[model samples]
Target: MHKSDYIVKYLANSTSDYVTSAQLGDFLSSSTRTVLRYIREIQAESNEHGFEIISNKGQGYRLIIRDKAAFQNYLSNSLAEHEKSDLNKLECQIARQLLLTDYIKLDDLAQQFNYSRSSISRITSAVASIFEGYNLELESKAHQGFSVQGSEINIRHCINNLIFNSFTMYQTARMLQVDDLDWNSFKKAATDIVKSRGLNFKQELLIQFMKYCYIAVNRIRNKRYVNFEQIKDLEFDIVSDESLTLMLELIQLICPEFEKTTESQWELYYLALAWEQSIYPVEKLHDPNPERIKFFLDIVEKAVENIKNYYGIDFTKDHQFLKDLAEHISICYWKYLLNVESENLYLDEVRSKYPTAYYYSVEIAACINESTKTKIPDDELSLITLHFAAKIERENRKQIKTIILCSTEFGITELLKSRLNKQYGDIDVIGICTCDNKVQLCHDNADFYISADQIEQSELNGKPILQLSPFLDEEDCHLLDEFIARLNTTVPLQSICEPNHFYILNKPAKKAHLLNYLCDYLLQEGRITEKEKADIFAREALVPTAIAPHVAMPHCIIQGSSFLVFAVLPKSIIWDQTRINLIILGCFHEGDNQIKNLLKQLYTVISNKQQVDKIIGCKSYDEFIKVMNDFVGEELC
Candidate 1:
């Protein structure tokens, strides 16, 4: 059954009222025309069930069902049939094979599967499109036949996606008939290996490593091995003899038959790669190579400079911050050289929740990538962001101004204030206003109000009021912490941008030319120095600031003054490597964490494809600003 059939059944069964095509399209992340096409298909499929889609022209669509039980039954049977289809299984198999193997002959595949050459060709063609998204190509040579052409790293990325995404890891392993003992043996060996190396493997990382090892073991057992000689030797540090001994022990421990395996080095290197990506505890900062340490420090040094320049937050003085960030960068560099992939569960959440910290990490990531010439994966990028997020959280702790509104009866107010200071080290208690004289409370610098009495909602005076027990229990502490986080809301993006900062460009230009043009305008307007323009290009070279498909926020840190520059090309202008219709250049001063939330808002506004389309179509600068203001202004902190 088509996906649209399921959607149609859902709509028809759930609603008696008219469901608009736009609503369906939005839910499916599809278009109205596509929804209509699906509706038509559903109508044809629903012939037996007497299902119909009635259109109400301007208002939208309604699902009309006759004999509801019959429709539900048809939907269930069709879905079951779709799931069990041989074609779906074959597609998964072909994709898995393409990802793991070097080359496959169409005729040989046809003969093996007992299918026609034409059928195999069609399957291979369909799988090729999937590989293309990862910058890989399916090419057929005269003698070699069909193979996925890309860098080994990219090929692994494609394979990882195929394995985890196309089917569950357990299911894929089951399909290969991999023994359960092999996985258990792999985990036991992994535990021993990490224990010996003083490294820790979180559950998420362990799962990924196990999957990779399973795939490698299956491939090796089938005589399909990655040739170590063909693999390029990367220059960096290598594991110690003790670690190598542990790896050899790990390989031998997987199975008694593993000792007879011809490709032992490949397996050893796989372990090495895993070890390189594993999280190293701060206590295990033992690098024998001083030069490598210096190399990483130099990268860190530059990153600190860029962060200080761009966001105005100087991390150099934060000793713990420097230590944590340095360790992360070192591992990141090693991972890059060895083509190791790191997984972080918090990547998406960090990107959304801590956009400011994530922004700095992006800057740091770009700098590292520029110097090292390797792309940082999103998970790894988020790991880097975590360090900055921690630092920012520390800074924010000092910035939060709290007020306690407790009466001086039995000296419980003083006791509560001291507990507040002890329980929440981040908050700053500015005043201790009595509950009876709530009107005397300070509202100007206060971020949160804590009271022992039942303060009415109206008495909050727009401030967040946390009602607490006089003794300060666990629940009250939790509530206070939650309220304190709300203090992060700062000045809006529109307030940050002035009339002169907005620009509308008509001429077509490439990314570099346009960047230079924008910088030239900034320089002429005396908003930025020539040196700052060079810094923007330098930052751009490290990472294209295109945060979304249509919007790119290219920015740099400059001395003295900061400017929020917004530009709309309306025409497709090359941004970084992609084409962008809008660019917001954030020229920031030192110690500026305020822009972090603004970037978050900018991303939220840009992520809406419909809103972006409307903004891009604006004819005048005033119209464009109005659209941007309406979108970002109301939501700004």
Candidate 2:
């Protein structure tokens, strides 16, 4: 390992406030003169990179890189060339470990690798060389050992650089072997590089380069390559020649390092890129205006061409596909800007075929959203409404069916009704009664009443009523509109379980266990299967199945899963260290449009804590089921 790399590692591992030169010399097991020489070299490099290296004379050095863009530029320039091959290998090892973890200790690392402390110290010095320009200091204090001293941003950059360089080194390690290499030593070396340099900048650059390689290689790897013409209509800029050359060099260098596991590593890298892109789209260079869109499409087309030239992946030049991809990319861009979910069926499908392109597309979209002020379209608003409705319906089903008691006159009531209808057209209005005759018209049937005037009766005989007059003055309509505008608009397809099939579980014990038990029972009865279980598990992983404290509803959309199974756990059990006492397992077959309604009914029963408590106290399974069926109605299942 390079001496500079070793110094960097040692400093990063040491989290002390300061490390004296004497201590650093001791840590390196070298003379004070040799340690001073290494420090001077690091300082020189730091100066060249436009960052200051603080020397406390007796106390050791610190690096500080304040400007992120400048730091990134410094990192890019630093890693642009691989000067010392052996140092690079050590650097790669250190980088990989840093990416995986936050910090490392020098002594622990030395012991793990069966190396002398001095050897680890040497590696740390070498790693520190890469972080020269970032105004960072490597400090070591009694008990603390060594650490990097600089701006948090600079420290992050150093870590990223270490990882990027380490990745490069890992790929090229086998070709150039230095004896006495171990995982601990390698990891320590990498960690040092990250501490001295920066990890975030390096990682971003590496990702960019890897994406370039992935696109190029995939095109040629497969038999059916996408034709450039097919993707010509899509827009995105091809990376510059200089950038491509750098990527090519990196690939060639690293290819030999992981020769045996090249394919797997490549696959993993691609998967990571795909996942990240699906979640967060790339930031585009230009805004999402018409001209900018055209420019983006051109860039994409150019990228597609480059992919064809480098790799043999066949890209369709279909205008519609490109257009759609661009639109999806745009959506992804906005989603990232809005901090929302971007990857769905569209991006997922694209990833299956053109993973690289899909990532680029999403990233471009994200950039567009960030750069431009795109107005939310009517369709987007509608989509948001549906998403909002889904959440509302999920949280409070009683609110789904409301009675709007307004005066029969066309002034306020008609205006209010029109506004309500516009916002919640999907909401079921059982009856729209005039204010004067609201008491006479269907008292027992209404779910809730929204009225302008306050009723004197206590809860209207225990029925829930929302008095909007106090909250909704003239100015409140605008506020309400704004709130509604912010609502999620994605519409979910109607579900399959009927209202009668819905069952509520109110008990708090063994929530997940009881759900699983009921699912197992249903499976035994030929109501569900392994596939259904798998599907349910997948959804649960994305978001917790526990909708409320001490409660969980595990359900799946599967064929032959028709009945809603309700299981009550009388005593709570520790699930994932949380007390869960209630489990509601709703199983549904394909083509069940009433599933949404069932969910609504279940939501209503659970939302009422009093009702839930009463239900939980029931002794027999039959009695429990009876209460659920009574709430949901018996005929619909």
Candidate No. with top lDDT: 1
* Candidate 1 C-alpha lDDT tens digits along 507-604: 87766677888889888988889898987887665443666556888777677555677777878864433457987788877566666555666666
TM-score against native, each model: 0.50, 0.37
C-alpha lDDT of all candidate models, in order: 0.65, 0.44
Best by TM-score: 1
After TM-score superposition, the amount by which residue 557's alpha carbon in candidate 1 deviates from its true location, in angstroms, is 7.2
Q: Write the per-residue lDDT of candidate 2 for residues 386-451, one digit (tens) a residue.
A: 332333333433245556666554465555556665555444556667656745654646645666
Candidate 1: 10-residue stretch with minimal lDDT:
226-235
Residue 340 alpha-carbon offset, candidate 2, angstroms: 13
In candidate 1, stretches whose alpha carbon ends up further than 4 angstroms from where it belongs are: 1-129, 132-147, 160-236, 239-291, 331-334, 400-429, 432-594, 600-637
